[model samples]
Target: KKDIEYLSLKNLTVELSNLVFLLEQQKLKGLILDYVDLKDNGDYSMEYNMRLNLEYIHFANVEMNFFRWRDFFKFADFGKIILEFDRLLLQENVLSYIGLLNSYKNVLYLEIKFCNLYILRDFHKILNKFKYLQTLKLNRYNDDRNSSLYMFEAIKNMNYLENLTINLPYRGVYNNSDYFFGMQNFKVLCLTGTNLTQEIPNIKIWGNYTLLRTYIINKAIIKVYDLIEILKIESLTKLSFLDCDIEPCFNYISVELSGIKIKSLDFTATNLDVLKNFDIFKEFARLETLHLSNCNLKSGWLTQTNQSCNLSLKILHYAANCFDRNDLNRMNNLEVLEELNLRDCKFYSCGFFELGNDCKFLGSLKYLDLLHVEINIEDLIFLKSFKNLKNLNLTLSDADFFTAKNLLFYLPINALSLKECNKKSIFENSYSRYLYEENINLNLNSLSSKSFILIRI
Candidate 1:
């Protein structure tokens, strides 16, 4: 009680009276009141003997409606407060919530999670009161289209807000000129979810509207105008179409933005026509990491991409698709690849065999996962060349196409991942059980020599 500076109550189901009694112990520097019972009394404004001296305070799953901030915080002073409450945490009385916000105008950092816009009657009012709020995190949950828009619309007067994280749901791709207002000075922005361009995309606006990086238009038909709009974002860098399906009506979706510095593009689980004709990487000169996993790149799409544009790529994760050795060989064009994940992929013809030239470009590769992949005996030998390899995950083929003893005999493999998928046969478990049956129990550490690459039958 004498030197207690930090106090955190998680999943608390006690009354405010009990919390008040705990507050009798002064000098609390930081307090996290998580899952506390703020609904114990109809009113929580009373005189207290002790003064709450706190710098950081976090309230989770608590309603501030009945809790009068003025009475409780007469002598209580805090700089940072995190309110992680949802619609359920609020009561019918919204004025008390506004009162609580008005009382804490001195806080520098404020984070409100799971904010339902429908219940945020005074959200704009509360925001206006916090003139000193430098950092704000508004994590909205399942609010309606209008409500979500209102929440964004309400974000004004935050002159000090430098960092903002808004992860509300929506359906579109937005440009800098489309929505974000009064937040032009923000340095750090994390839009963890979908942000539609205005409620409607057909609204004709005056020219010279500033276009941000890029926008992801969802559940909408792509037209010529849409394609043109995508190209307008001059500062486009990273693009992710998790499950968006874009029509391949156009024979070619040529992008000629030479200044488009896209470093990472994720088209995983996204269905599109031919990745070849699109030639979307023409202007993606600075593309570093690309994820086209499960993109249905059928057979020969990889070879068609502009090789010069992908030279800067360090991590190429394209797996769980049907492609052959001839197609995989095109990856050799990406001369500076550092990491490659070819797991759970189906090859029309063996994708990993005779890497005589297919494996030449992976000079900088540090991490490789060849789990449950199709390959032959020669492909296993192909791994020795990757000198920069650090982490390796090897899962032998379900079918014994490559019969080689001592499956993992590479030297200097820092970390190894071995997973057994075929439960019926343990003998084929990374060629481990076969050694067990042959009375040849080999310790991995005992037989790791680089100079001699041994393969026994």
Candidate 2:
């Protein structure tokens, strides 16, 4: 009976381990362990046994008892492993404890955040010996000026690497030193919190494997010219700039074609006037989706200029701006446009009337978003003219004038989202009122329902 209980407990522990793995799987890659306390877990023997059984492991805020170092080292020799030690109170003695797992060559992804600088230096030296390493992400907790440079030098030594992401928390300029030297075959490179005031380092120096498809810059103070130089690379397809002050003519002025076949472009606080000229669009003829948020433009610039380019544009999103009805009318000419998203654009009264009359060419539109626009419910009623609209989003609008009977009249609409509206009392007042009075399903949720549906707040 005791043996049976032991086996049951073992199975329960395995199930718990799998559950923990599943919970962390979504946030981090592969596996993640955050702040596991080892001191109060009684004997250190079971922890070493668990590590031995775990083929893949990720640790964040984990505490280890130094007494089990030998057993843990032996168990780490099995398969893939990832160790993340963030905000650990190592008490100055953690370096020797960490040195035991230095020979783990099969670790595919490794991340170390917020450790003593000296301990990190030793960890860097240990990581250099890993032959099969693919990804290395390091975040320095200290504010030392030369810490990032030191980490860079350590990374340059590792030759057999594919992806590298680094976060430099210090306040200084990152120069081309020993750190940024040896990443010749790196397919993806991401740098955060570094003072990249000048142009991005020339990517041509990184050899021909140019697998850099995605690049993100957050709170960067670099100029538009600097960014244009980086875009000259032919391999980059996705680029995002957040809180960046890029010039309007960055794309127009840069004559060099990076050969970059950009598919999606996201610009926030960046001047898009660089794309005002039709020549830039010709270069990016393959662009499928364009996202422009918080950008300043002269209302009808995009609609007028985009007519000249041979764009296979399927989706165009412009939010949080002042666009006139004429701009919306001009977009109807884009015959291939499938999805149009215009949010927070304070429209003049009867703006929807203009769209209804002029935007007849947008017959192919499947999805339309007009959230927070100051329009009447009559505009939504007018949208019944569109024969192919599959999804409609009209959240936070003053469109409550349309009664349930009026909504049942529109038959072709598959999905309608009117969240947070001023019409919750109507649902209670009409149980079978819509069925008897209007002859349509009053509480319909399916897309196929041609009845009056209400998704109340």
- The TM-scores of all predictions, comma-separated, are 0.64, 0.66
- For candidate 1, the per-residue lDDT at 61 reads 70
Candidate 1, 153-176: lDDT as tens digits: 545556666666665335442332
lDDT of 2: 0.53
Could you tally the backbone clashes for each prediction?
Answer: 4, 10
Question: What is the RMSD of candidate 2?
Answer: 8.3
Per-residue error (Å), model 2, residue 262 = 1.3
* TM-score of candidate 2 to 2 decimals: 0.66
> What lDDT, from 0 to 1, does candidate 1 have?
0.57
Show the lowest summed lDDT stretch of 10 residues, model 1.
448-457
The lDDT per prediction is: 0.57, 0.53
**Top of the candidates by TM-score:** 2
lDDT tens digits, residue span 1-457, model 2? 2221101111112233343333334222233445445433445435534343344555555455566544555564434544544444562345456456546666666655556443444445555555466777655544344645555556666776677766643444244442453355676666555444533443344344367676666545554555656666567777777656554442345456635577766676566665555244445656667777667666765554345222366777777766776776666566666777777665543365466655644467788776656545566566776678776665422235334346634533332334333344446645335323343333544423222334322
Worst 10 residues of 2 by lDDT: 3-12
Query: How much is the lDDT of residue 386 in candidate 1?
Result: 76
The regions of model 1 sitting more than 4 angstroms off are: 1-87, 90-99, 103-125, 128-137, 159-183, 186-224, 247-256, 274-278, 357-361, 398-405, 409-457
